[model samples]
Target: MTTTRTVNRAARIVLPGVVAGVLAASALAGSPAHAADEEVPGLHLVTLTGPGTSATPPVTGAPDAQAVLLARQDAVLETIGGPATAYRWTTALNGFAVELTADQVTALESNDDVAAIEANTVRPMAGHVDLSAVRFSRSSDPRASRGAGGSGVVIGFVDSGIAPDSPLFSEVRGLGETRAGFSGTCSPGEGWPASTCNRKVVGAGWWVEGFGPDRIRSSESLSALDVVGHGTQVASVAAGNSDVSVLMNGRTMTSFSGVAPQAKVAPYKACWAAPDPADDGCSTADLVSAIDQATADGVDVLNVAVAGPTTTDTVERALLGAAEADIVVVGAAGNGRSAFAAHASPWVTTVGAARGNTLRGRVSVVGGPAFTGASRSRRQLGPVALVLGADVAADGAPTEDARRCLPGSLDARQVAGRAVACLRGGIGRVDKSEAVALADGVAMVLVNDRPGALVDDFHTVPTVQLSVADGTRLTRWMKRHDRTTVRLAGVGIEKDASEAARWSAPGDDRASLLKPDVVALGEGVLGAVPDAWALFSGTSAASARASGVAALLRAKHGHWSASVVRSVLTTTARPLAGTSTLVQGAGRVRASLPRPGLALDIAPTRYRDALEDVSWEDLNVSSIIMRGGGTTTRRVTNLGTRAEYFSVSARGFVRHRVRTTPVALRLGPGESASVRITVTGGGNPSRFDDGWIVWRGARGSHTRIPVAISR
Candidate 1:
C-alpha cells in the first residue's frame, strides 16, 4: 500500500480527431427531426440484428430465443398497428422496449428485423473505495480471515439498489459454493425481502420499465432496495463484507474492506431516484435491461455505474453483449473536468478518478492557521465559536444564501455553540453540513470556492473540507479576527491532497483507444450506504473498484478472457504522476497483479470488427495510441511458463521515435509474438505524447506497455 511513482505529463487531444468511421456509426435510427411523419411520442429502444437474436436466455440455437425475439417483436407490432410491447430484451440485448410513433419510428427504419431504433435517453448516476489503496492482493489462507480474495467471482451491480441490511453484507465465512454457471435470483422487491439474499448478496433485480413508472418517487424502491445511496455505495465498493465497521456519526470510523472481499454480489436495479432528490436517472431501456440481466445471470464481473456509449449505442451494444458473453465489463469514466471520459466501449473497463491518501479533518485556527481538510468527522470540537456563514444570515437570508449554507440559510442565534464557516457552492457538501447541523451547529468549515477534490463527506456536523487556498485563509481570518477561535481536529490519514481529479474525466480525441482504461482509488472512497458507512466520490467509485479488480482477476485466472481481463488491467497499471495520456489512462490500479508475462487477446470478433471497421487503429490493444504518427501491430500471447525471454524497453516517447521490430523476445510456452510498433516523430498534430513499453523479463518479471502519441 505505498505507491508514489510520479511522472505527470500526458494531456493533449484536441486534433482533427474522431473521424476514422466513428465506431462505424449508425445505431440509433430515425424519428425525432420530423415535421411530417408526425406521431412521435416516447419510450423506444428496438436493436435486433441477424440470427434470431434476443440476447440471453439459452441463445445458441436460439432455444425459443426470448420466444424468437417475441415473434420479431410481434411482427413489428403487427405491421405498425403499434401500441402494446414495453420491454423484451433477451439477456443483455436482442431488444424491444416499445411505445414509439414517429410513424413507428419511420417503420422501424425500413425493418430488416431492425438493428437500431433510438429514443430512450435518460442515463445519469455515476459515482467509492480503498483496499490498501490498490496494492490489493491478500489471502494467505488461514481462511485468510474468511477469504480476503474474491472466491467464486460474481460481482454484477448495474446501479442504485442493494443495502440488504448492511453489516457491509455479512455471511461470508468461507464463501465456498454458488458457482455452477450462476443463474441469479432473489427478487422480493419493496423493502427488499427474499430473505435479503444471503451468502453475501447472491442476487436481486429491479428495472422500472426503462425508468418510467411515472418517474418512480413514491419514496423510491420498487425493490432491490437501496433507497438512493448509489446502489448501496456501489455494492460496498464491489463485494462488501469483510472487516466492516467504518461507522461515522455513531462512532466506529475505520475497519473497512471490499475490492473483492470474497466477491459475489449481484444487485441490478438500473438507477432511479428522481423527483429531484437531486435528480438521478439510468434508462437506456433500463441499461439494456440490466445488461441483459447480468448476461442471463451468469455474472462474473459487470459493474457499469452508468453513462456509457461514445458510439454504437444500445448501451454500446449491451457492452458488446457483455463482452461477448464472458462478462468482465466495468465502466464509468465520467465526472467532468470538462467531460470526455465515459465508457467509450472498448468493451468497457474504463474507470478513472484518483487522489489517494485520505481520511482528513483537522482545521485549527486559534491564533489562526492549521488546515488538513476532507473528513468523516470523528468529533472533538473545542475552542469553538468561529462564525462567518456570512456571519449567520437567516432572518431575511440570502447573503449569498448565508454564504452557501443554503438549507435554511443559517442564523440559529448566530449558529449555536459556534463553528459554521460554510461557502462552497450553493448546495451539497453534505448540504453544507446539513446547513450546519440545522443551525445548532457545533462544527463544519467547508470553504472551497474552486479548485477541486476535498470531499470526505458523510457529515451532519463536525466537518472540515476547505481548500481554495484554505478557503481564503479562513475567509481572511474571519474578516480580520474580532472573536473567531475554532478547532475540530481529530480524524487522521492525509498525504495526496491532489493529483488528478478536478472531477476526473479527460480521455477524448475521439478514440483510437487510450481512454480511462485505468486509474482508481477515486477521491474519498469509504463505501456501504443504507444502514450507514459513507464517503464516496466518482468515476462511479472507480467503476466499483474496477469491478473489484475484475473479481480478483476472475478469482485467480480461471482461464482469463474478457480480453484477457482487459489486457491484465491495461498492461499492469501504475503510471500516474501529474497525469496525462488524456488524464490517467493506464495508471493507478494495482491490485498486486504484475504477471502478464505477455497477453493481448481482443477477439469479440475483433470487437465486432472495431465496431464495423475503418480499422480502429488496429485493435489488439494494451494501450498504444499513435494517432498521427502511426504504424501498429501487436499479438503477444505466451502467458508464462518455460522458455521466457523479452527485452524491449521504450519508456515514455516524450517526442516520439519508437521503432521496435524485435528488440528481443523468445516466447515458447504457449507461444505467439508479433510486435511491429513504429510511431515516427511527434511534431504537433496537437501535441500530447506518453511513454512506457518495458517488457524486460529475464526473470525479474515485467510487462508495462502503455504508450501514446498525438501528432
Candidate 2:
C-alpha cells in the first residue's frame, strides 16, 4: 500500500529558469508569481518527468537536468513513455520549473519516455453532491420538502440526452416508448461494424450477411422519448414536486417526492437501446461522446442508469475520465443477484433501489417460507414526532410543515413534550432545528429522514430515519392511543431483510469493487417532481434525500471537503440489523452521529496523502505460461522530487487478473512503478490481453496506459 504523491513546489524539482526565478525571489523576499518588481524574479510552479521522446526537445535536453529543480513540486516523475519493465532505467524527473504554455506542457508529455505524471493540487467537492454519502437531500420550495436537490444545486441528467422538448413528454402523458431494432450479439460479419444501432428495422436488427448476436435499445429508447418512463422517472426522483393530501381514512396521507424540486436539471440526451427480454443496453462507444460532451460543460452530478457490464473496459475508462473532470458519476448497482466491489471506488458512488418508493409505504415483511398469516396493527408507545422542513415545504421547512400539519401529538394543552421529526433534508439546519423545536418538552424526537441516504443532521437530542410509513403510523397511533406514557416501542418493521432492492444492479467488478452503498425510498417516494407533483423512486431520490442532510452538514462544516461528507455518512450509517453483506454495505446510512473529534478537519486515514506522486510499488506475483505466455513487470517510477503518495488502482481486464492491496498506496523518494502480473498469453492479443493501466491521483486526472500483457 505504498503510493507516491506529488507535493507542491519546495518538494518538487525546480527547473533552470524557475531556479533563477526562485533565486531572484529569494533575492527580494518570497513572492514568485509576482516578484519581478523589487529585483525579484517571477517563478512558476511545475514538474517534469520522462520516458521522453520528442523530435525537438525541452527547456532542458534530458528531462533530468538541474533546471527541473526550481519548479518546487517534488521528486516523483509525473509522465512516462510506456509501461516500464525490469531494468528499464525508469527515472522520475520531478520538481522542475518551466515557462511552457498549457499546450507546451502537453507536447512535453507526448515524449515516449514519460510513464506517469503527478499533480500538485486536487479538486474538492464543496457546493455539490458529496459522491461519498450522496443522499438526495430535499429542498423546501417555499412550499414542500428540501432534500438533496437543493434549489441552487445543478444535477444534470445526461443520458442518450434529455428529450426535454419531446412531444412524447412535451406535456406529460404517462410514459413513452421506442421501436426495437435488430442486429444483436457481440459481432456482425467480416466487413460489418459492431454498431449497437443496426441499419435494419427487425426486432433485433436489419438482416446481417450471416447471423450474429442481436441489437436492442434502452427501455427509454424504445421509440425515442421516455416512452418506457426510465429517464423521466430518474429525473423526477432527482428534482420532483411534492404535495400532501388527506386520504379516505380522514387521516393525513403523504406521497413519494423527489430529492430536490426546483434544482435545475439539464438533460444531455443520447439514444441507446434499453434492456428487455431480448437485450441489454448498447456498446460503450455509444455513451463516450455523450460523457465527453457533459464533462466539457462541467456538469455536477451525472446519473447513469444504462451502465455497461463490469466487463466493459472502454466503459470503465469513460467513468474514470468523467471523475477527472470533477463530474460526480453515479449509477445503479446492476440487478444481477450478485455482488462485487468495483463500483465502490472512491470516485464513484453505487446506489440501490428500495422495492417500494411510495411515500404511503406498503412495507412487506416476508415471513418464514410458509407463515403467511400475520396480524397488522398500529404502532403504539412512542412519542409522536412530526417531520419538519422541505420534506414539508419549499426551502425545506420540515419543522414548519410538521407544526402546521399537526399542531401537536396531543391537543395543545396535552402536547407538552411531543417528539418532533427531522431529516438531513437540504435546508441547512431545518431537520435538526425542526426536531429541537418539536422535542421542546418531550425527551426525544423521531428522525423522519432516511439514515441510509445522507448524513445531514443537528443532534439536538435523539433521532433516526424510521421508514416514512412506519414513522407516520407510529406518530399518529401514539397521539390516538398513548395518552399518558409515550411508547417509543411500536409494532412495526425496522430494516429487517437480506434482500437487495430491484433497482440495485448486481455486481461482478472485483477490480472496480462494488457494493450496495445503501437503500432508501426510490420506487415511488411521494413529494415533488418539478412542474406539478408525482411519486418518485430510485437511489437517486435517496441521494437527493441524503443531499438534504448534506446541505445541513455543509452548514455545519463549511470548510469540509467532499471526502469529509462521505466519511461521516458511511461511518455513521446504521449497520444493517440482518445477516447478508449484500443488502447494506456498512449498514443503512444514519442521519445523526456524535461529531468525530471536535474539529471538522477530517483527515480520513485512507486519505493521508490524497494528492501526490501516486504509484504502485513492491508489486510481486507469479504465473505459468507457454509460447506467448509471460508476466509483464510494470515498474512505476515517482520521477517527482517530493516524498508522498498518490492513488493507485487498475481495471477492465479479461483473463489478466489484477489486484492492489490497501486500495490507496504511498511512495517514498525516488520510487519506481513495478507490477509483477502473471497473465496468460493465450488470447486474441489485440483485445483480451490488451487492457488499460490507469494512474489517477491529484491532478483531477486519469491515464490509460494500454498494455499488451501478451506482447
Candidate 3:
C-alpha cells in the first residue's frame, strides 16, 4: 500500500524568492563566501530504475527490498555531500527531489544507478459550467439518470487549495455518502482541520517542501484552506455541492452548480500563493508528489488545472502512470493562444476553453449607436459627460499612464461626475476600475485592444467594456467633438452559442495526434471561492469541467476502461460551427453521455509505440490524424446489446478526399471489426483540412470521429 506524507517542517532550506521581503530574509541568514560549497543553485529531480507503488502484479522481492532501494538512492546523494531531500516518491514514480549545486547535478547525470536527472520547473495555475450549456438537463436527457450526480466517483484536484468553510462544499441534506476504495486522509494545518473533510470533501493535503516558507505570504495558510481562491474555484466547478446561490460583490448573480455536483472532492494543494502574487505557482517537485499521492489514493478522476510543457516531463510521466492505473487524467491547454498546447501527452485529455454564456453591458453614445460587451456590473448610470482618460491625467503624470487608468494617475477635477474611458493593459482590469472610482468617476468604460476572452470581472464602479474596433471609433468621436456624453445601459445575461475563447491555446504542430482533445464551457463561469463566489475563465477552468464529465462517466460505467471513456467522449462530442479543429479540437464536450455503438481501446504497449514514433496516424483512437494524404486502419468493438448494421461516410474536406473500404459493416454482440480508410490530397491551395467520419447505425446511433490533415 502507498501513503502520502509530508517532509519534516524543521528541516528548512533557504531558497530564492520573488519579493523584497524574502530576498532580505535570505540575505540576513548568512554570507555567500562562508557557504559557497553548500550553495544550492537550483532544484533537480532524479529518477531511479525501480518499481513504483502501482506496479502491475505488485513488486515481490526479499524482505530487505526496501532497505536495498534506500541504500541505492543514498549512494547517489552521498556523492553530493548528503544534501537534504525536499521530496521522495514511490507511489506513482520512483524518484527524489533535491536542491543541488551545478556540479552535483552534473555528477548525478552520469551516475549509473540514476535513470534521469532534470531541472524542476514551476507551472502557473490555469473552471466551469452552467450545466445547460453541456446538455445537462434533468428534464429531458436519459443519460442524466445513469450519471446519478457522479455519486460513486472521487475527483482529485491538484490546485491551490479548497475553502472548507464555503457553503459550496457543505454536506447538505441530499448529498451522497463518500464511497469506499479511497485510502486518503486529511492533514490538519494552521486553519484547516481534519474535521473539515466531510462527506462532500473526502480528503485534503498540502505540499510546501518545494515552495519554501519564505516565499509564502504571511497571511496565507500553511494548510489546505485556500487564500488564493483558484483551487477552491476549480474544485467547486468540478464537484462541489450543486444549486448554490452565487454572489459577486455581495450581489446575487444566479444559482451555480458543479458539473458533477455529488462527486467526492480530494484536494491536493501542490501550489502556494507567493508574497508577490504574480510569482505564485506550483513547483515540479510538489506537482509530481501530489499526482503520485492521488494515484495511490484510488481517485477515479484527476484534474490538473496548472499549465505545463507540451512535451513529456516528470509530471507527464506521473500522469501516464495514473492513466495506466485506470484514473481519468484531465489537464489544461495553456492560455497563451499560441500553437503549443500544454499537457500534450496522449494519456492526458487536454481541454481548451469555450465561451458558453456571458453577462453583456451596453455602452450607448447619447443619440448615437450602442455597443455591447462582456461585463459583471449591474448598476445603472445615465447620460453623463464622457472624458478621455488622457484628458484627466494628474499633474506630472504620463499621458499614457492616464490612458490606461493607472492608480494615482487620474485627476479628480476632470474625472468627477463623468464616465472615464480607460484602455486595457498595464494593470489588472479590476484595478483600472478602482482607479476610476478613486478619482470619483461615476462610471468607467474599458477598451479591449486585442482578441481574447471577454471576462465578467467584478468592478469597483458601474463599468461597461467596449470592443477594440468600437473603442477606436469612440475615442475618435470623443476627440472630434467638444462635449461627449453616453448612457450606461444595465447588464444582462446573453448566450454565446458555442464559440471558442480566443485566448484558449491552440493545438501544437508536432503531435501526430491532435492536442486539446476538446473544448468545454469555461468563460465567465461562476463558482465558489474563499467564502464567496466569483467568475472564472481560461483553459484551466475548462479542464476542471472536463474532469467532472469524466467522473460522471466513471460513476455510470465502472467497468469501462479509461481509454474507452476517452473514446466515447471524443466520438460523441458535438462540433462547434465556424471553429477550426486546431483551436476547438473535436468540439465542445457534452454531458449527455451517449453510448457509442462501437468503442476502440488502445493497449498500453501500443500507446508507448505510437508516442515514440514520429507519425502514428492509426493509433486506434476515436480521432484520426493524417499528414497530407495517407491510409490507416482502425479496429472497433461492438459495445451495443444486439446485432447492428452501420454505414460509413465522410464530410467537410476542402483539400483532401477520404474513402473507407467496405462501405457497410454488420456486427453481432461482442464482435470486433477493422476498417481501412484512405485519404488522397486534391492539390488545392488549402494546406489543411478537417472533417468528420460518421458511422451511422441502423438503430439511429451516430459516432463521429474527427479527422485533421496537415501538409
Candidate 4:
C-alpha cells in the first residue's frame, strides 16, 4: 500500500467520544510498532496469526523465507515496521516469518499450505449482557414511559418473517408467515459454518421471489427465514401489538408492547423458514444489498441481531450510508464476558444487554422418578444442560414448566412472608426477585434447574446458580438447606445491555466495542410470541426493544442525526466504571426518554459551585477552587418565558470521572439565580483540571455549557 493511502486511512479519523473513551483504555495488546527480538530484547517481534480458522489451519506458502506460525484466528490485519512486520493470524510455519498484507493472507488460505481457518466470535464478556437491545435503547431514551410515535417507521427484521397469526403483531403486517421444516440444521454451535447460529426460523420473502419465473433459488442464493422463533421474538419485541385479549402466561394480560409497535416491519429472509435452517452465508455483498433494499423501502430502522466474524468491512460502509439516510441500526451485544468486540461503528449505535430487574424469580425442579435415587444418578451424572430448552432447568431451560406465576396462585397471605420457588424458567432471575418482593411471605426466591450439566443457571435471589445435575439432586434434597436448591435473590442492577446472548461470536476481536454489550432477562421474558404469549431470551429480544426505543426517538426528533442520538445516549448514560475504563464507554443506559421537565447538557471543565455544591453528585475538587466557606452554586438566567425546567449534572475530570447528581431547578425568564449542587452517586473523576456542571432541558437536549465548581 502507498504511504499516502495509509496516511489517508489514518487521516479519515472520526472517533466518537465513547470510542475515544474506550480506545483510551485500549492498552496496546503487544505493540503498535514492529521491533525485532534482537532490537527489543526479550520481546518477540514476530509475524503471527491469520483469519477464519474454521475447519483446519490456514496454510501460508512463503518459500525460501523464514516462516513462523503465529496463533490462529479470524480477521487478518497487518502492521509493518521498517523491514520488520507483524501478522494478526495463526499458521503452521516451520521457520520464522515476516509480516504480510491482508490480501496476502487471503491468498495463503487458497494455497495448500494453510492448515486451519479463523472463525470470529471467540471473545467473551463473562457475567455480561446481551447487546441486541443495547444499541436500540442507546439510540433512544430508555426512560420515556410513553412513545412519541411509531407509525410509518419500518424496522427490517432480517431474520425470520413474522408468524402470520401471531397475536403480538396484531398491529403489524407479516404476522404468522411461516414455512415448514426450518430447524435443527445449524452446526451444533461447533460447526465451522461461516456464521453458525442456533435460533433459526421459516418464512416467505417478497424481497426474494418464491416460485415465479426467475424466482426459484437455492441455499447459496437465498436468505433463510426464521428457522427457530428468534426472528419472531425480535420482530415482536420491535413491533408486536398482540391481537385479542392479551393472553400472557395463560391469562388475559395487557397488550404486549414493542420498542416500535407501530413501526412497519420489512421482513427480509436472511435465513430459511424451516428446520432446514439454511446455512446461508451473510456475505458482505448480500448484507450491503439488504441495507440498500431497506433504504430503498424507506426503512426507518434495521434490527440485525446477528453475530459474525469481523471480516466484512464491506457492510460497514453500507451501515454508515444507512445512518446518513437517517436509519437507526441495532444489533445484539453478545453473551460471554472474556471476549471483546469493537464493531460499534461511530455511525452505528452498538447495543449491549441487561436482564429483567423486575421482581419475579423461579426454581424448576423435577420430582417423581426424575428425582428418585435411581434417577438421581442419571440426573447427577447427566445430560449436559448444553442449552436451556424453553425449560426451567439449570443445564437447560424448563420445557413447559418455566412460568411466572403458578396456576394455583400462591396466597398472598401464605406466601407473602415466605420466599417463592418459581423455578428459573419463564420467570427471569431478576423479575422473579421483584415478584417475590411482592408476595408477602415470598421472603426469597430459590431457583433449582433440571438435572443436566453444561450451562449454569443464573438467579437474582440469595441467588444460587447450579448445574443441571446439582439442580436435579437439589429437588430430592429440597427439605435440606431449605430445598438444597439454594436461595436466589438479587443482583442489584438492571440495564438493557443483554451481554449474555451476544457472546456467541467466535474469535476474540481484541476490541471491547466488538464484544458482548450487556445482558438482559432472556431466559424467560414475558412477551407476545407468534401463536401465543410466551417468554424468550437472547440478545435478539433485547435488540428489538432497543430498536423500538430508537423508533420512538427518531419519531420524536425529526432530523436528529445518528451522532446526536448516540451523543444523547453516551452523554446522558450512567458511567459504568468506578473509574472510566476503555470497556464500559458510558455507564448503563437509561433506556427511557428523558423526563419532560428535566434537561442536562454540560461538558467536563474546571470550576466550582458556591451553594454548598451538594446537588452536584460528582465533580473534581482539584479543579474547583472552593472559595471560603462558600457552597457550590450556579447562576442561570432563564431564557424561556414563565418557568424553564432543566436538570443539572456535572462530571469530574481525569480517570474515574464522576458526574454530579442532577439538581432539579426552575428558572423564570429574565431571572438570574444561584443554584446549589451536590455530589450524589456515580464514578469518581480524577482526570480533570476541574469538574463541570451542565444544564439539560426537558427537551432532552443539553445546554452543554460547562459550569465549573470553584475552590
Candidate 5:
C-alpha cells in the first residue's frame, strides 16, 4: 500500500593519524627497539611486498612463502620499537595484523618493503532456502538421489560462536566423521567443553582478548558458545539437521531443513558478542586469525556472513589464500544501500537479501482495487465505517501528527466505531495501528504516502495497508461520501513467493562491479537459534542459503573449483521479473542440474580505472563514459561431450549497442574460445545502464553475463 522512501545509513570508517613526533623522538634517540607495553592501543593491518611475497600465490599451503615473509616481518619488528610481545596474525600476502604504537606504525610504513598500512576495521555480520528449487534436495537430483546432502564436505562459518548442544549440531545429522583434511582444534573454556569439537562440528575456536579468568562475563561469555545467536542461526541455515522444526512464538513450524543438512560445520568465532545480540563486534585481527586457521584446516567452504569495509589488507590477503586453496567463500553485502567493503573484494561471493515464502494476510477494499500488502493477523474484518485519521483527531496538534496517527493525537470518542484511515510516515506501521486501537477504533487502514510502495506490518487490531494510488482513491471517496466502508481479508498460506527487499544492500560499488552475485530468501527466514529456532532477516541470512547451495554443489562435483561453482550459480540464476541487474544481480538462485553446453568458466574482468588496464578480478565492466564505448572479452568453454552451436544476444535497454565479433560459435567438446563484446553508448550516461549478454545453446541450455555502463 503506501510507498515510503527508505533511507540507508552508511557506516563510517575513520583511521586515526600516526604520531610523527613520537617516531622522530624514538629515531633520534637510537632507542633500543624494545618499548614498554603501555605504548599505543589501537591495532593496524600492515602489508609488505618483497622478494618472496605475492598477493595471489599459486599454492594455498605455501609454508615456505609464509616463513620467508614472517622472517622479514620479524626483522622489521626488531628494527622498529617493538613491544615485549605482540598479538599478530600473519597471512600469505606477507601481511601482519598487530596492535602498534604511533611510532611503530610510522616505522613500519617507512620500511623499504612495506606496501600498505591500514586500520583493523570491524565488519558487521550480515541466509535460507528451499533445497528442491536449487536441486539440492529434489528426489531426482543426482546429489539428492545419491543421498549426498553435502556428505564429506566441510563448510566453515567465520562469525560469532555457535551453540554446540543444539540438535542441529548433532553428529547424527552430519557426516559423523572427522574430515581427514581438517587440522584445527577447539579451545575448551567457559561453558564450552572439549567435546564441542565432534563429527558434526569438527573444529571450534574463538579469538577475543580479555577472555581470561578475571573478567566479568558479558552476554556472550569468553567461550566458543553462541551467546549472540546470529552464528547459530546462520550455521543452521547453511547446514542444519534434517526434518527440523522451528518454534515461532510458541507454535512449531514443521518440516524445515537446511540446504546441506549433512555437511560438517567448522565454527570459527571471530566476532564477539555485543550488548545488542543482533549487532556484530569483532576486530580485523580476529577475522584474519579465523581466516588463517580456516585455510590451514583445509575446509571446502568459508561462509563469512559479516559486512564491512574491505580496506583491511590482512583479512583480504587471508581470504585470497583461502580462495587459492579452492574454498568457496561467501560474504554478505552490507545492509546499507551502498557499496560494502567486506563484500567488495572479488574473492568473496557476495550475497544480498530477497523475500522468502511466508504466509501473510491480504487486504482489499470493499468496492475498490486490491492493494499489495501483508499483515500477521489471520482474522478478517467485515465491512466497517471508514474515517480519515485527520478528521477524527484532537485539535491543537499539527495536522501531520493526526495524519501519522500518533498516539494521543486521535480523538477516542470520534473514532470509536470506525476503521481510521491513517497516512504512512513519521511512525512505525505497527505502532500506528496500536495508536488507533488505543483511541478505541475497531480497525485501522494505512495508506502509503508515496506511489507504488507496499510495506508489510504487524498490527494489534484489525488493519489493512494500501498503496498510495489506492489510498488516495479511498481517502477521496471517504471525503465525498458520508458512509464509506472497506474490508480486510485474511489469505491462507501461499508458496513460491519472492520480492527484492528494500533493505537489501544496493550494488553501487565504487569499482563498478555488479554486486550481490545473487539473492536468496533472507527476510523472516526460520532457522536454528540456540536451543530453539527463530526467524532472522538481513543479508546474513541470504549468505547462509547460498553457502548451503555451494556445499551441495561441492558434494556433487568435488573436482570443480570454487570459481566454477560461482559461475554456475550466477549464470543459471532466475532474474527477478521487474528488477534491474544492479538490484538483483543474476537474480534469485535456482538449483538445477548443470547442463552440458556452452559455459563461461569465468565472468569478464571488472576494472577499477577508466583505462581498464589493471585487472579487476570479479568486475564485469571497468568504466564507460557517456556517449563513449568500451570492449571486454570473455572465454566460453564447451562442457558438453559433443560439438555445440551457440548464438549470442543482449537483453535490456537500447541506449547501448552491444555487438559480439562472432555472433555465433561452434565449439567441440572441451574446446574454449574467447568472445569480444563491444558496447557503444548512444546517449549521455545519467545512471547505470544494466543488461546481460546471453548465450543460447542449440540443446536448450543457456547462460548469462550481467553487464553495466555508468559515468
Candidate 6:
C-alpha cells in the first residue's frame, strides 16, 4: 500500500493573494521550528537556503550562486558523511539528493543552512492523440496554417529512446531547423551512434546506472532504439511529419498524421528496458539528468510518458526548473486506475487517457443482442455450435483453467466442431483466444468479467466480447438449450466521441488537489513503430498529444507565456459526459488561435517551499465542504485589446446550490477582475456534487472554472 501525508484544512492555501496570508497565518500560529524526523531511509532531497528569491533560482553558471550552493553542499556532506557519490546536486533547486540514514537526515536537518529534507519518492511510468479532436487539422482550424503545423518548436521526450530511422522523423517532410537555443548533443554508446541525431530528431542521449551496456538493449530489439515501441509511438504522435501511412493487418491502408508535424524532436532516453517488454523502468537519477539536459537544451515542450510516486527530490526539482524556464511540461497520470503521485506535481500538466477510434469485429447471437469486439481474424463464421468452456473441460484440467480457456484445459474432441465461450480474467484476452484456437474451436466468445467500459483487444481467432450482464444471460441460455449459435462479421473501424479510458489514473492528490489536468485520445492510437505502424494505448499517448498541441500554440503565439498556453488549453477543453473533474480534469485539451473575445488567465497557487514540499494543490475551485457552505475567490485577467462583456453562470448538478457574486462584468483590454463563488448545501451532503462556473463572453469565447462540493 502507498502511504500519503494528510494536510489539515487550516493548511489550505488559495492562489493570487494567499501567499502573504499563508505566511502571516503560519507565523501567528507559531508552528514548530523543526519537523519531527520521519526516519525513512533511502535517497533524500535536502534543500538549502539560496541567495535568490524562491521563484527564480540563480542562473546555472552564475559564479556567486555556485559558490554559495557549493558551500552549503559541503556543510551537508560534513553532517551526512558523504564522499560526494552519496548525493547529487540539482542546481535549479539549490538542493542535493543524497542517500542518508535516518540519523543522518536528523543531523542534516539541524544544520542552519539546510531548509528541508524529504525522502526521494519513486515515480512509476504512467503510460496520445487525434489532431482533429484538438482542432490541429487544417480543416478544423484555419489558424493551423499560421504556425506551419508547429514548425520551429522543439518537443523533448524523456522516456524510452525513439527509432531514429523511422520515416516519420524525416526532415524532407518539413521538419524545420533546430532552434538556436538548444545546446544538447547525441552521445553515442553501445549500439547507438551520432548519426541518430538529425535536423528533425535534433538530440539523442541516455542515462542509466547499475545496468551495463549489454542490459541497455530493449526487450524487443538489440539496440538503443525503442525495442519496447512505446517511445517511438509516443514521439510520432506528438510531432511526426505528414503523409505517414500504416499497412494495418497487412492489407488495410491507414494514413496517419501527428498533431504538430513540423515540430523538432529531442529524444532523451532516461528509462531502461525491463525484463518484460511491456514494462519499462526508470530511475530518479536518470530522469533528473534527462530533465536537466532537456531544459538546458531549451526545449519548448517536455512530454514525459512515465509516472511514479510523488517525490520532493530530483524529479520535482527538475520539473520546477523547467516550469520556471517557461517550458510546457506534460506527464502521464499513471495506469494504476487511481490517483498517482509522480504526476501530482502542480508544475506539470498531468494527462489522463480517453478512447479513440478503434477497429473491431461485430458479434451477434442468433436470438440475442449484438456486441462490439476486436479480433485480428479475417474469417466470418455463421450459426456455429457454441459451447461454454466450463461444460467441456478435460477430465484432469483445473476447472478455473477451463473457464478461462487456458491451453490444454479443454477437451479437444468436444470443442473441435463448436465455438467456445470463455470467461474473461485469469489470463490475457488474446491468450484465451489462442487457447481456443489450439483446442480446434471454430470461434470464441469472450465474456467481460466486470462492469464499466471495455477496451478492444486483438485475438487469434474470430471472437466477440460481451459485457458482463450480457455475457451472463448468454451463458445461462447456452446451459439451458445446449445448442446456442452466433455470428461473427468482418472487421471495421468504429469512431466515437472520446471517453475517459477505464485504465487512465484518477486523482485528488494527498492535499485533495485535482490531478490529470486533462484527458485526450490515447486508446488504440496508431503511430510509428521502428519501421512500421502499430496501435498504442495509455496516458503516455495522451500526454504526447497534449504536448503536440502545446507546441502548436507556442509556434503560433510565440509571445504567450507558458501559463497562458496552459490556461487556454484547459479553459477551452471539451468536458466529457459522465466524468468528473477528478477523472477528466479540465477535460479534453483543445487548440485554437487567440481570438478577439474574452481570454482569461488565472494564476496558480504559489507556495513558499513549493519545490521541497509536495503538498500544494493547483489553484482551481475544487474544494471539500465541511460546513453547509464555503466561499472562494478567483482573479480573472482579460488578454483581449477591447472591452469584453461577460456573464457568469453556474452550470452542472451542483450549480443550483452555488452562486457567484457579480454575475456580470465588463472589462477593458488587459484588465483584471475578481469574483466570489459560494457553494451551499441543498442535496445529500454525503455525496459529492460538481459543476462548472462558466464565464461566457458576448463574442462566443467561453472559459470555465470547475467546482467540486463534498462533505
- Residue pairs with clashing backbones, model 3: 127-541
Tell me the tens digit of each residue's lDDT in model 2 across 1-711: 222122221232322211000000010111111111011122122333321111012365476433344222222223322211111111112222223344444544554333232221101000111111112233222232333323333444533223333211122211111111111131232222333221110011111100112333323332223232344445555544333231212333334444444344444433333344122122222333344444434444455544323321223334444555434466544332322322433444455544431111121212201111111123322434333322333233344444432222223222345543333233332234333545353423333344232121222333333444555554455455423233332223333254334334333222322245544444334332222223333344444444433333433443444434443444334443332324444344444422431111122222212323332121111111112334445444332345445565555456565544334445554454454545453456443243333445453333223333332
RMSD values for the candidates in order, in angstroms, are 23.4, 23.5, 9.2, 17.6, 11.2, 9.6
Candidate 4 structure quality by residue, lDDT tens digits, 425-516: 44444455444444433333233444421122221223334444644455435434332222232222222343232222222222212122
Name the weakest run of 10 consecutive residues (lDDT summed) in model 1: 23-32
Which runs of model 2 end up more than 4 angstroms from their true locations?
1-149, 160-225, 244-253, 271-283, 339-344, 353-495, 498-514, 521-560, 580-583, 590-711
TM-scores for all predictions = 0.34, 0.38, 0.79, 0.46, 0.73, 0.74
Candidate 5's clash total is 12
Best lDDT among the predictions, by candidate number: 3
| Model 2: lDDT of residue 121 | 13
**Each model's lDDT:** 0.69, 0.33, 0.72, 0.36, 0.63, 0.64
Mind giving the per-residue lDDT tens digits that candidate 3 earns over 62-95? 3454455567678878987998898877666567
* Deviation from native of the Cα of residue 343 in model 5, angstroms: 2.5
What value does the lDDT take at residue 626 in candidate 4?
27
State the weakest 10-residue window (summed lDDT) of model 3. 19-28
Worst 10 residues of 2 by lDDT: 19-28
Candidates arranged by TM-score, highest first:
3, 6, 5, 4, 2, 1
Tens-digit per-residue lDDT, 382-408, candidate 5: 677778888887867676798889888
